[model samples]
Target: MPSVQIKICGLTTREALDAAIAARADYCGFVFYPPSPRTLTPVAARDLADRAGARIGKVGLFVDPDDALLAQGVEAGSLDAIQLHGRETPARAAEVRARFGLPVWKAIPVTAAADIERAAEYREAADLILFDARTPKGALPGGMGLKFDWSLLAGYDSPIPWGLAGGLTPHNVCEAIRATRAPLVDTSSGVESAPGEKDIGKIAAFCAAVRSA
Candidate 1:
């Protein structure tokens, strides 16, 4: 299998951003959802993103956000890509792309084989696809740190690049890569000391595992 591409999501601090950069993560995700503990203001996101520079891809994560908010995020000039982590339709994804002229990644929640079928819809709408664990009923959409069965992705294929996320940590990342052979993998709570608190050591360890996979 090829080496995994690591994306550290929900970053809120310069320390964490620096840690992610030093770890050489392929992508750094900034949450724009207000309910999420890792959420960042547009200004804050821009600052961290500016600090990240060109060392990694900056991803703006949102959950069914309005076009105005999305426009503000894009105008901030910190993000290279947008990740729709909500119940957005394929048309909405396309609209965001067309309006902003930025790459789009639509996140799909997977818990069963049927869930995998949803990937087909976003394949044409997004430049990339993110497979994350399904948020339980009555819960927030994402950043819950939950993981679904990796075996479910064994035969998954799509024209767009795909990423595996949720509950990924230093210990299980290698196995997750080996099982799903995901070219890209993302983590948020898994590398944190607590909810919204990123641990630099864990970040480094997780990156090391990804590089060695």
Candidate 2:
């Protein structure tokens, strides 16, 4: 299996953070959206980031947040990247990048082939585009453990750096990677004991699965 970058998202505990570090995940994601089960405040996220101590990429996940919230998260968490998981327009993404001088990653929900094409409009605005499974309306933005058709990404072309998310578990990540040829993969509920509760063993196993793929 070729090397695949891994991101453990929705981490809210130091134990889980340590597991990600030990497992050599490329990114550590902290949700800033209040409604998420794994959401963290800037202050708490700051402490976790400090504990991570440059061992991993610290990503601050937001949902159509304002400038003030973005500033606060960056200041407190020392974020390495900003993930826009809401219905943020391309112009807004560019604006945030200009204002914060941090790498911007846009989360695009995919239920149809056309949704994947949406990344074209964000080429200049975001450094990364994460394609995730589309959830039912009124559900949480992500971490619902839903997955899109991997065949949709077979030989897929992306305008920017990209990753796969949603419904990825240790059992299927290898198939997902092989099918999509995704260079990076992100998981939250996939390695969790419950919503917002990460399982260290699963975390380690998932990373190993990616490596073995």
lDDT of 2: 0.94
- Cα error, residue 105 of model 1, in Å, equals 0.4
TM-score (C-alpha) between model 1 and the true structure: 0.96
User: What lDDT tens digits, residue by residue, belong to model 2 across residues 1-213?
Assistant: 358999999999999999999999999998998999999987799899899988999999999999999999888888999999999999999999999999999999998889989999999999999999999999998999999988888888887999999899999999999999999999999999989999999999999999999
Q: Of the candidates shown, which would achieve the greatest TM-score relative to the real structure?
A: 2
Q: lDDT per model, in order?
A: 0.89, 0.94
RMSD of every prediction: 1.1, 0.9
For model 1, name the residue pairs that clash.
none
